[model samples]
Target: MQQQEIKALLSDMSLEEKIGELFQLPSYFFNGDMVTGPAGELGITPDDLRVSGSCLSVVGAERIHEIQQKHIEKHPHHIPMLFMADIINGYRTIFPIPLAQGCTFDPGLAEKCASIAAREAAAAGLHVTFSPMADLVRDARWGRVMESTGEDTYLNGLMAAAMVRGYQGENNDFSKKGALAACLKHFAGYGAPDGGRDYNTVELSERTLAEDYLPAYKKAIDAGCALVMTSFNTLNRIPSTANRRLLREVLRGEMQFDGVVISDWCAVSELIPHGIAADEKEAAVLALNAGVDIDMASPVYLKNLKELAEQKRIDEKQIDESVLRILTLKNKLGLFENPYKDGSEADEKELLLCASHREAARDCAEKSFVLLKNEDSFLPLKKGKESVAFIGPFTDNQLLYGSWSFFGDEQDCVTVKAGVTQNYPDADVFFAQGCPTADPGTNVLGFQKTPPKEEFDLQEALDTAVELAKKADKVVLTLGEHRDYSGEGASRADITLPSCQLELFHKICEVNPNVCVVLFNGRPLDIREINQKAKAILEAWLPGTEGGNALAGILYGDASPSGRLSMSFPYCVGQVPVHYNHMSTGRPFAGDYRTTRYNSKYLDIPNEPLYPFGYGLTYTAFEYSDISLDSDILHKGDSICASVRVTNTGERPGTETVQMYLHDVSASVTRPVRELKGFCKVFLEPGESRVIAFPITEDMLRFYNITMDYVSEPGQFEVFIGSDSTTSRKAVFSLC
Candidate 1:
């Protein structure tokens, strides 16, 4: 269908039919049974289901085909229903979480993982995926940080654009097989909730919002993302779902996003609880007028939109515009020609968890594992000779896939015990459960099912682990928070390992001189105690399906860990929202002024993080020389290159992510000490030396000035190029 045809169809739709197209209901509403459960409680009637434009969280090709057949048979306009779900990281063949993928620092690899996820999801009859969350997160206490790419605007925008390309394909053609429309989510400042709580208020100035949070979403939209989902939080004092200034003036107007806009789960009706609307009718009017084209999982649009239009309280033209956008998306998906576009049961069977997909997952996990500590080069253990003891809750656990793996089966996951056995068949590998992943009676959200009952005695498990640690030559202590601990609605006040696990580790360390720690978690943890006690530590954050195999490869000399930290690991929970790119203060803390109490410094702890952003360790070491600039001045229409020589000084092959940072020494407003501008991941063999060059353009220096305009002023700037954010190899230049 073309533009004229879509417009003609919209003109023919009745007022009630157009209103129905704006409501998105769940899959159970179309089950053909009497509404008597959650749907009935929500006041969703049969008429609402009959004309709904889309369904949420629906799976299976056969079930989707059946639902589409039933819906088309009854829908007044015969518009096909769009099937959408939370296919964030993976569908069935799970991969590393978004944070871990960011550690890889390879946008190409992230794109591959998302492409595979899209293929698996498309085969299962999913038409849209609510993913590529472009939120910029700095607080580890926020559980949803696991879903973001990390703290840097450049890296977040880079990864988000790659994911958009991966999901929609290069041509943005959803009509092709294995391509699903992508929806960038949690619009505005969903990642910076107050106190790091979920759905809490977000307080940010327009400059900060534009300079930090909005760029990533704009990157995805510029890459042709088909839809944008309103966030649950309030930007400033207005809820994002009903903030016309945010949705209409900013997102659709300034961002130039002419795509369908959908509300987050039930966010339209949530305006009432948010103290912005009086009732359902007011909520519907507010959201539709604010530029929300679809109300997801909410009955306000179904129950009140028609009446609001009839009473002249809301414009009917808004209804027609929204219905047209929805129809345009359907036509873009080629659904008008074939409602069940390429959904096949055979394709699902052939694509899900295939060998190639497993290999890709393993490779990504290998690149994503960060070697945070490698004292005395204790890793790459003697596989066949050493008697190793694997002690802790995650030693043999199959729950390696983290939260939001909607369709992945834990039974199919490969455990660490199994991976080690496969890699070191002749070694004596002992195993013991140090303690449960968390204490009993832990509070889990109702949406996330309750954990299984702990059947073992805690003291006994600790004793068993200690004895095994004493007998074995080396101990591989595996530990982490439970999988449900870090996801949506799973925020925590303390971001550290459980007390029982800490006790178990202390006891084992007393008996064993050599210990290697493997962590499976979602967010950056407070690991001060673990850092002091362990000889080696590997941050394997929620590696999916082939997690064990990937860890084994790194431990047995098969691969080197090249992953870097996207978010900073704090010194303690009190240093909650720490990042590298913080604005410079008037009274800044300095080493020379440590004795002075008047400066901005913490009395008990350092202001810096335990591990700063872009910080990580690899098996091999790389040496960097001083940065050399091609020119000392940069003018408007030309660019200069900054070059640095990096050599693999250690006796092994490795990959190094050369990072380039810029500092605006004098600006209209306070600027960060250093900001990441460009990066390159280079692979090298031992004794190999390569010079990496980054082209510096004036456009890269632009930022929101004091007057709220994006521009760059002429000034002297400092540049640093090296391994991580703290590198001191610097060069000076001027923008004239």
Candidate 2:
């Protein structure tokens, strides 16, 4: 329905009916104590007060039907509640965590995961999934990093669009049998919280917000996401839920996002804490004017929206617009058509945990493993070579299934020990717990860092692992942050491997240098110390349900590790804001630091990252040569073509990702040293070579101008073609 028509209908309604449209009753109706529904003192009985609609929780088909029947009976409009849930990763067939999914560098996989998650959610009677968190997370110190795609704006935008398409489909209708409404959450600058802390203040320049933060949300909006959730943090000095410039000018006006804008949980109430609104009435007025369509889990809007409308404090048209959006989303879900549609109940809870879903999870688990280093082919441990010792707290534990895993069952998840036993039935496989993941922060200065209490002993586990490593022919040392280290509200001050585990690996390598280190981490880590001693380093980034099988497959050469680091692997945390796309400093550094030259360089470590974004190694080798550009100068809208010859020089067939980076040597505003423009992935057999070609145009070269319009600047551009971020062949070009 059009806003004008909804306004006409709402204008004819009484004050109580207008109030009813603004209120979203709690689903706590199922939790008993359902006297009134609104706040404590100003409550009204269910029979007395008229509720326009409600928000519900999904339990089962029969239960949903019961609630729908009861809810419709109370409302004269017969409006049904919108059922919502935090189905982030999956509803039934859980895949890898979002971070791991991002590592695959394949939007198809993310889309597929979203499709499955949507399917299961719709089947279970869920109308909306609060997901596809398009927040561009730069700091791995944020606990919600696991939920975000990664640090890059373009990559996050692509994945966000893909996931929104997967969830809501090309059409925004959720009435379809396999569709659920997509909610692009934490709407503006939620990722850049102070000190990478969740729900903290976000102080950033307007250009930074437009250039870095807002693009992903725009992508989600373009993909036709049904709803957008306001972030908890304040942007600049104003709360995002109440920021008119962010929600109105930017999101609705500039981006033309017509979908519903919902407040984050209790975020409307937080406007008081943000000191923007004096009370609930002012908060309601601020949020409504800011274009927040629905107030979630906050009673401020329910309490004051109608009174504001009646008193002309808020435009009656705005109230109707917000209500219409809420009702429209419900209508889109076919809730208004038939709120109790799924009446059929079956014995399918067992079928929810199917083998096909598990297999898909396994495929993703394997594909997401990144091989950081494989010196001298120490990997692909032959079927029956020598004794292999698997050591660490997570080597055989099923709890390593990362965070935000809704459907990954501990019983169903495959452990490394189980996988190894299954792969090499007759081979000698030794197991050790190693040290506790959380350890005492004992230092040489005799200062002790208190450790979180765990159920296991630290020294015994380490001693047992060391003893086993001494006897084994080869040792597979698995180490990383505990599963709880990177999920929601689990940010760490120091993003390094646990001190004890690092020490353990160093000691174990001293005893035996044949250590194959498998890192199971939620986010990037500083593992430079272990990288030096470990013969092979496999980054198994919190692989989900079939993780063990995937690990065994990669270790035994059943599959090649093709995943690249979506985020940079920092050598240390001091490089907190480090990225390849950093703006060029006034004086850029060159050559080694020992020359005593004053330039933009770090004193101790090289400016280079430990492992650049898109950097990954395989057991096999691929060579890049023969770079050519069609034209050095081209007119606007003219295409410039380039190609490079890639050859597989190893015995085994593998996939190689050719990355194309562009550098605008000079621009109005300082540009990044390098920016990823395009990429292509291809598979090759042993001794096979193929010519990879890419066509670049003005669109690929566009940047936000002083007027905030996206346009390409006339400049000398350097094009690079290579295997990863660091190594490439350069060719110069100019646009005329």
Candidate 3:
């Protein structure tokens, strides 16, 4: 239905129905915290779902069916409440966390994972998923890095589009199985938190917002996402939840997004803390007038909206528009036609975690593993090795799937211990919990809040790990952030392995020179020490459910790790803002010693990251040679073909990501030192070679032009081909 038609329908709504459309409490409201109004006249009984036109939680099939049925019986308009849940990663079938999925560099898999998640979630009565967080995360210290698609704009955009397609599918049909509406969340620059702190202030120039932050949301919007969730952070000193320029001017006007704009949980109320609004009433007025259509978990809209409309502070038109959009969303969801339509279908299922879902979970986990470094053909560990020591806290812990993981049983998840045992029942495998996840200084003072200690004592655990390593032929050390390190409200000042763990890693390496390090992390981290000590490094980003089987498969040559780094790994946290594509400084790096020291280079560390973006190693070796270009110059509407020969030199089959990058020698505005234009992943057998090529046109070179118009400028461009951004062969092209 057109929003205008829905507005006419809302004109006939009673005060009760209009107020109902304004408030949407959290699922905790029904399951736990029951709020009563001061007068006790207005509220909902826990057992009475019928009177509640909108609600938040829907756990299992049974509760969903019961709550859904109850709502159908009571609502006067019989409009069903939208069943919403934070099914961020997966519903019942968990996949690798978003960062790992991004590492796969496969949009098809990203979409497939979301589709499976939607299928399981929709089966359990979920109408919406606050997912595919389209925030462009540049800071790795932010705990939410795990939730984002990584630091690159183009990569994040691709992942966002894929996720939306996966979640929403090709149609708006919710009756069939596919995805529930994919909520493009934390809209705008929430990822640019001050000092990488979660929910901190984000002070960005308009150009930075447009170039770096806004593109992902724009891409998500273009992907046909039905809803958008505002951020909790303040943008330009205004809380995003109440920013008119962002919600009204940019999102609705410039982007032409007509979907429901929902505020982050209690974010409307947070304007008080932001010091932008006087109270909840003022916050509601600011947000509602700014084009926020839904008040998520904050009752301020219900409390003051009617009064505000009556006083003419907010026109009835604004309220009606908001309500109609929401009602339209409900109608599109088929809730109006069948509030309890398939709510009962959840109970009809015999198994929630079936074989197919688990298989998909395993496949996702397998693909998300990225091989970072492997010297002396150390990887694909020879089957039936005499003995191996599995050392780390994560070796047995199943909670390493990161945060917001649903429907994945910790006990059922494949731990490194279990996987190794299952994969090689005959081989002797020693195990040890190297150290506690928590820092010692912090843990001692926070005993009251901390969980009970598990495994061995911290020092003893490290000692045991070192001792066990001495007895084994090789050491397979699992390292990196624990489950609690990243996710909601978890940010870090230093993006490095905890000192104690680093010490343990060094000790294990000392004990057994033949060591393979498998990182179980959420986001990219500084790993200079690990790079020096370990002969091999693998980034296994919180693989969900079947993470163990996947890790074991990579270890035993059953599967090859092809995933690449989506986020850059800094040598140290201070080297942040270091990406593959960066604008060259007026004083570029000089080759001379004196000039290099004073130029745009850090005194303590190199400007380059430990591992550049698009950098990843594979078990088998691939050689790059024979670069060819169709033309040395490009004209208007011309496409340049850049081709290269990629040959697998090792005695095994493997996949290689053939990347193409471009550099602008000089332009009206400085361009990135190198920009990723195109990439193709191909599999090759030993001694087999293929010519991989990419065509680049004006569209590929277009940027926000000199006049602030997004267009391509005629200029000299350099094309590069190699494994990553930094190490590549270059050829110059002139655009005329």
Candidate 4:
């Protein structure tokens, strides 16, 4: 099945058959087949399902094989249905969340995690994964920040491309069954929703969208992602699903994304609600004309496309184009020849949470945990001497897998208590849950079950934790938001640790002053107070299936915490959209907050984030020398090399994410105070020194200006190179 074969098949498909290819219906198997699932209520008949080209959210290897085989028998053309699912971070062998993965700033490690996910998911016969979500999130309140890498444009682009490569492999060949066609999702500014709320309006200028928002997606395409998904939110005033200028002009024409453009779940139908289309028929017409290739979980295309084509409301050629794209992807996957595609109950069982995969998960989580604060080096605690109390809701609970770990079994997750016991069996280890992780309506992800009636005793739990703290030499207090607090429809106004956990921490600190706080969260939390109270703080954002094993390794000094922050942690929730690479303000706050009137400063707090982007700490420290440039100035079309020598200033071996930032001293349009251009991660032994060099080209300085033209105006530029974005080791150079 090649391009020629796809073209011939497109010609042979009937109108209804072609329409079926455009519609991707939902499928929730096993106990979730009805009552609350999307498939049972989506109003799709057997005939409709048979002709459908893809089914999403279906799980189990054997079930997928059954569906595809059954679908082929009913369809006249016998085109096998593609199995798609949101295997975001991992399949069964979960790794750290994408946010935590990004903190490593090691695309190589990100690639490894994605490769493991691809292998586990391929065992389940998935043809495509809606992953490597390239959305650049600046706000912590955006729940899907759990899925995003972080706030920066360049950093996100690097990780996005790496994931694409990992998913698609060297070529788009899953012949041996590991790689899948990666879908770069929520195309065009889905992360920048208004108010940092999920699915909210997105208003952005052409320059901002093209410069900051579009790069990551474009990078993914360049890495050969097989598909792109339309966003739920509107870009500018037009919804992305129906916006022809976006889907056609920017994506298809400008970016040359010839891959199948699929809509997010129900986004095609939601265009009617967005006031763009008057009815479902118009929605279908707009979506096709706008270049959306598939309607995901929306019956609008299946119901109205045929009628719209007959009525001459939409061109039939648009239908042919979309069907062609789908068939071509299927051809690339070799699905036309082998529809089952290595799916079997036996293979799934063999690959699910296998030993090597668990080890990979452990490695990923170990590198992804960031030491936010380590007062007097309280961490890397020796297991034999210090009797420790691991008291928290997360201590015995198997909720380590974050949201979107759809295929992972929570029971399979190794708990902190179990991991600790495995490591230090004889040590006196006291454990108590500070509070319930979530009680009743606390879940915001639309749980249809009756809300639990709770009589959770906050003070009783606190007193128990306090008593345990007094008995142990040190208390390992774990705290975080409920699992449902991030990912999908889970935006929060507070963006802090749950109140019960915070209150429990205060009470426990009254008994044990040498307490260490281990944070298990999705998005970055506002923990200004917790950092102040605790002797040590570890930010392990939803470390995946083997989270406990990885946490144990870090706590016991088996590995040093190496992850850096991809997104800035806000000083408070009031500073919603804080980041390190913000554009320079006309009136910069030069003095202290109280003294800085008429300047860009917060009344209650400083404008700076609690922790800047690219910030992280390990058991050891690295010292950076002032940057050395190859030349003071250079002409256009020339490149300059900036070099910095980093020394492992501390005794222990550690990994450091070396970041390089650039600033145009003067530009046609006002530029950011600093923009990340390049970075390198290096592991150093004690007294080790290595010189890392970054080659900067003219293209790195280009940006959209007032006329919407991307240009790099010749000017003096400042280059900063160090461990993080706030590095002051600087050198000056000029471009003419």
By TM-score, rank the candidates, best first. Answer: 1, 4, 3, 2
- Could you say which candidate leads in TM-score? 1
Error of 4 at 166 (Å): 0.9
lDDT of 3 by residue, 1-736 (tens): 4556566667777765676676775666555435464212334443333334456665665677677776666666656788777777787667899988988888888988888888777777788888889888778888888998887888888899888888887765655554588789897899888888888999887767887788888998998888899999888888888889999899999999998888888788888888889987899889988888878776678778778878988888887777787888877777666665444453336335678877888888887888888988778787776688889878887875766675566776788888888977886788888886655654312111342366457877788889999999888888887666788777777778878788888888777898888998888888888989788899998998889988998888888888888888988889765677878897887464334666888776777788888888887888888578899888888788889999999888988888888887887777888877778889999999999998978787877756777787877889998887776588788888
TM-score of 3: 0.94
lDDT of 1 by residue, 100-180 (tens): 999999999999999999999999999999989999999999999999999999999999999999998868997899999
Alpha carbon deviation, residue 423, candidate 2 (Å): 3.7
RMSD for all candidates, in order, please.
1.2, 3.8, 2.8, 2.1
Compose the digit string of candidate 4's lDDT tens values, residues 646-689: 99999899988888999999977878899999998899999999
Candidate 2, pairs of clashing residues: none
The window of 10 residues in a row where model 2 has the poorest summed lDDT is 442-451
- Provide the global lDDT of candidate 2 against the true structure: 0.78
lDDT over C-alpha atoms for residue 510 of model 4? 87
How far does residue 18 in candidate 4 sit from its true spot (Å)?
0.8
Model 3 per-residue lDDT at 203: 88
**Can you write out model 2's per-residue Cα lDDT over 588-704, one digit (the tens) per residue?**
887796664689877888787788888888878999886789898857978989889999999999988888888888887777777777778889999999999989888877778
Cα deviation of 422, candidate 4, in Å: 0.5
Model 4 pairs whose backbones collide: none
Candidates in descending lDDT order: 1, 4, 3, 2
